[model samples]
Target: MQGLAQVPRLLLSYAGVQFEDYHYENPDHWFKEDKLHLGLDFPNLPYLVDGEYNITESGAIQRYIIDRWGPAELLGKDAKEKAKLESFLSIFTEIAGAAKGLFFNKEWETAKTAVIEKYRPKLEQLDKFVGENKFVLGYLTLADFVVAEDSHYIERLFPEDFKAFSFLGRIRAEFNDLPQIKKYYEQPKAFKGRFFPEYAAVTIEQ
Candidate 1:
């Protein structure tokens, strides 16, 4: 149930934003109930319900949460930095999009090579960009979270390919080691699995 929805929750936790997290073991509650009741303009899986702000779309929700609750630097220090972060985000989106064939379509046997090949150049760029830096943009920002989350999937699903991207593992490890993230994982309720539902064509425990 975590899946894509888990990303914002991780950002919320890291930002020290206290919010209720509901994991629907069944989809009925969302599709039949909440989707109809929640006043979101665009109803989606990871919608956020603040007292008056109802937002959907993972990228927008991440921006809202970080802008409202996280440190100012999380978004970026200036316009140029924000632009760079968005560029990294674009790469992440493409990499994740390519993974859909392997995970949801049950195409791993035939699609694995294509997926890994698709990631090679993008990952190399990221490794070079992140060379020895503690975080993207040289400090914690939304890009780090997005990249780390995607990297977690890659590392778990394609260990060999992931190993070649040295900085990715470092970023994920450093992110997980952050005080807030470490505390979140230490909580009894924290759960980890493939970033997809159990019914997915492929699953990897992360």
Candidate 2:
């Protein structure tokens, strides 16, 4: 299963860049030990250590990967496309945060309906934006990876509603078909089990 935090790794894998895939199984190990020792300005999960660069935050890590080891077009071709990419990224982040809130607040059972209703219109808008395009923004961009990973959470936790999202499904299929991604999936990796961390009250595996 691909976790939302694994988005940067997915981008690196797609670019065929070699990187260490580290997993912290125990929360205490991170919060009590490694988090304190790592020289990161904001110690956090999914931080990337590339030479002298130590970056935290998933979005920043993702952009770094794209800029450093890129199929440069992933950043978008022009200013307009870049702005659209950022818009999609912002929406994707909103969706991911909402999903995390369900478990973080321990309101999955109670808040599920409102969560679905709130995001359905947003997803519908995204669907129209994507329409028949091969990718979001009409080309492959980092937002595609972000949306693809976030969609899995919706599919698993809100399957009944997610079924209507043919555009999302199409983008996901296209993402999986990429040669680098196909190769990445074939290799053994540690990103498995629940989508959220163990502390979360609710979990989903896809």
Candidate 3:
């Protein structure tokens, strides 16, 4: 459970969005109430229940929030910016999706190192794409939020190998430099970093 799930919280916070948060950690029981207001089933742990609409997929959930609450910066102003942002985020999201299965592996028999080597190129591509850019798009936006969350976790898994992809290192440095990104990331209490047990577990293993 990396803070990858906290992307929306950061994006929305940065966009000055304030709303109630409903959580059902590993809600396997599927005990969500009737599909009325925000009609979402609790079966999906991270489902976003927004006024009779429950979006199970993480990307859709995040983008919808941006499209509605943050019509400008979070998404983009014009077609070019929005398209670029979307392409960038889509690629980055794929990287994260592909990396997670390996990054999250508990196997220690050279599997982790092998996985790192395999995904190093993906990380590099991400780095090169975001090189020297203050944000994913022309400015701070949802793309940055998503990538930051993904990298924050991936770095924890392969800090040293991460440096091998110099671009990733740059991206990491960039996010660290952004006061607003850091501030927005730290604003929401429930989605805190370094405190989550998943993070602690990673540390303990390290």
Instruction: Point out where model 2 deviates above 4 Å.
Output: none
Candidate 1's residue-wise lDDT over 68-127, tens digit each?
887878888999998888888888778876775577776676877878887888888977
Off by over 4 Å in 3: 1-4, 25-38, 41-43, 166-190, 193-206
RMSD of 3: 4.1
RMSD of each: 1.6, 2.0, 4.1
The best candidate by TM-score is 1
lDDT of 2 by residue, 27-115 (tens): 79999998999888998877899998799987888888889998888989988888988887787678767876876667687787898
Mind giving the per-residue lDDT tens digits that candidate 3 earns over 51-170?
Answer: 766676677778877777775666777888888788877777776665565544556335567666676776677667766676655466777666656665467667776666554555
Best by lDDT: 1
- What lDDT score belongs to each candidate, Candidate 1 first? 0.80, 0.79, 0.62
Clashing pairs in 3: 38-51, 38-52, 39-52
Error of 2 at 188 (Å): 2.3
